[model samples]
Target: MTNLQDRYGRRFEYLRLSITDVCNFKCQYCLPDGYLGDKHQHFLSVDELRRVMHAFAALGTSKIRLTGGEPSVRKEFEQLIEIAANTPGISTVATTTNGYRLAANAHKWRQLGLSQINVSLDSLDPELFRRITGNGRHQKVLDGIEAALDAEYRKVKINVVLMKDLNHQQLPAFLEYVRQRPVDIRFIELMQTGLGKDYFDAHHISGESIKQQLVALGWQVQPRGPQDGPALMLRHPDYAGGIGLIMPYSKDFCASCNRLRVSALGKLHLCLFTECGVELRDLLGNDQHQEMLQQRLLAQLQQKDATHQLHQGLTGVTQHLASIGG
Candidate 1:
């Protein structure tokens, strides 16, 4: 099949899939406390997730990212990654995790053909970190990072969600830590949604701020490949790999958007800001829907929006980040 392009002239072949809605942490931004799955909440069984994966892979998706509130928290997470990685035409298979259990599970993931790991590490400050997550175990996350390095995983990227008047003071320290490690660390701007808007300011610290500070520290900010999305992919002059800034809310990458999302319960969302979706859950009734499902997915991509504009009124931004496949 030809590379599917949107009306904006960009291809739509990458997908981020949320395998489950379950998560272990109560991170104020992603999943605040006092939240519980009510009677209406639905989760995709492993087989159902694979069916969607097969359908999309057949439609020319080469890269699949496994995400969840924490995908690693799922019981058959490794098997899911293995299936996606081994799928025909799949060039890359990766996952995003909070890293609490990484130390023990990185090898398991690696053995299953996982390509890259994007782990969330908000702060090195244990107390502040605990407050942010509403859970302890900062050391566990740190250990998981080290274990990924020790296991010689192909690439390890640390995702830091930047919040003002909170952990902004620790940015320099975070950079210093990445400078010594082989990993690529990215500073992601706090997104606007749910508890995030109430907990964080709309202002996002730019890649320029990070570049300037790196220069002050005597490190040259060298650019990296592709240069898509929120990450201002850059390498350091003396450091081994690089540092990245994914300032989405501060610097939107709406025009070059090259991805789609499949929610945990078989809903396909075209944009992060769009509220409605193309429900594939009904297709679960029969294998006859596979071909039609592929067509529906393509039709949805044809109408993909150029930008999220999430900062604007979120009257339609209903799905939680986890449910929407972050």
Candidate 2:
């Protein structure tokens, strides 16, 4: 089997597959206006996703992350997780969600073989969370975390998108919440997407600021696993939980990129901010195209740019994060 290596020699072992673009929450950074696209649009079928997973596994990919506007919103989410968990050569099957359904379904999903989970929890304050996500079920999300822990998940990850004058000042609260929990709180720097130029300018804050705070507070950096996402993991002896900072604007941020993304419609995205994606749905129509599908994926990796052009104020075709399950 061939490895999915790009021109820059970065081996791709992780795939972020979006099951659907339809999200329930109207997060300020992503779909603040809410998902306006057709909710019934044709996303990849379960069989198509199976074929995609097999093709990637054949190419040395061992981790598959199912993402979406919210993956749990899909009717066949459980089936998708089961398929990924049972797929040969796939050792890890993870999913990122808004946690709306996690409180009730965490145990069932865990039993279905989900190995990892990341839930978006931007604010600890219920009202603040409601304002940021346009959802008032903040307590339900917290319960979801507990349910995941009870389900025997080794570690749960909380994704926090830091916004200036928004949830940025609540760092103390977040640190306190994780003091006794085993979850890893990931603070993501607000990114400049295609449609959020003004909002980005108003709210964007550097993750470096958070890192400095962590370092001064006696937190030490931790080594990352081979398939870990782009985050600088750190640990504190006094705290049971960990902290991670995802600073995409930092120097050489893309140098260690080990993952690729596939949109819900089966378009392969080499970079999150790429100008466009290459369609692969036609090749996914049947298992007979497995060889051809792998060839197309390998060919496209050669064309991936060494890095994204976000610093140059270009977001490409990504009008918003939800469009590709950011």
Candidate 3:
């Protein structure tokens, strides 16, 4: 049997892996302008990623999400998806993308059993989009969304991050877009991370506020299956797809947090709000280090906090959000 239960009793069923640390867009919330990493190194070869996936698969992980600075930019990302898809017991293979390069590769990704695509689209206005993601390819992103929708990607969720004074006004318009488009529109509250510290301030928007707005618009908010990370999903009276709220600030969800994050350079993060991480890439290189590191991985999984302490009181952040592949 897969070693699915951890030290804390949290199931090790879901794994999120960052395929690369690079990105094409300079999203303002991700990295600041003139950001430089002259000597930064990336993590995990396609083979290494496969090994990690296989190891985790032995632990009962069947759902895996491939993330990145922008995963599509990773060389031959489709190959990585294929490898993960073919992994034993990995039933769900998904990605969180900015949707810029998705159009050109949607068909290939779908053919490889990619089940979900979460696109981050902050604003409908191109100027605002450019302001939000420094690279400014809103049209391309939208086109990618269309292509994915056409390709029948199992579930396409649009991530609309609402920050006050930025794109709050577009909430109604975005909801309208989702209503007619058949995509599950998930509104995410701005998170406090490296970008929250180095690039921008925390944009306050709560799930209660969002629910109130939806109520005013003649919609009802009904909570669906409790999510593992931050998103709490709800549905309208007659809407086919549901609306999800990702509350990293308002609610500290550690008890039901069944996810683990693998950074681009192979650091294992048990919590999004933690300062500590296990450097797996470095450990994997030394053949002499494998046994000890393997034991440590299991120990840390047992120590994984059910929720994060971020909600404790806006503690200052140090890790760059870009580093986490948010």
Q: Clashes in model 3: which pairs?
A: 7-302, 254-306, 254-307, 255-306
**Reference-based lDDT, each prediction:** 0.76, 0.92, 0.75
Show the lowest summed lDDT stretch of 10 residues, model 1: 221-230
TM-scores, all models, native as reference: 0.91, 0.98, 0.90
Determine which window of 10 residues in candidate 3 has minimal summed lDDT. Answer: 312-321
Candidate 2 Cα outliers beyond 4 Å, as residue runs = none
User: What clash pairs does model 2 have?
Assistant: none
lDDT of each residue in 214-259, candidate 3, tens digit only: 7787776554443344567666765667788776766545555677
* Candidate 2 Cα deviation (angstroms), residue 245: 0.4
- lDDT (Cα, tens digit) per residue for candidate 1, span 4-53: 56788876667889887777888867787623656387677777777787
Q: How accurate is candidate 3 locally (lDDT)?
A: 0.75
- What local lDDT does model 2 show for residue 106? 94
Task: Give candidate 1 misplaced runs (Cα > 4 Å).
Answer: 202-208, 215-228, 250-252
The superposed Cα distance between candidate 3 and the true structure at residue 69, in angstroms, equals 0.6
Question: How many Å off is the CA of 260 in candidate 3?
Answer: 0.2
Please tell me which model should have the higher TM-score, number 1 or number 2.
2
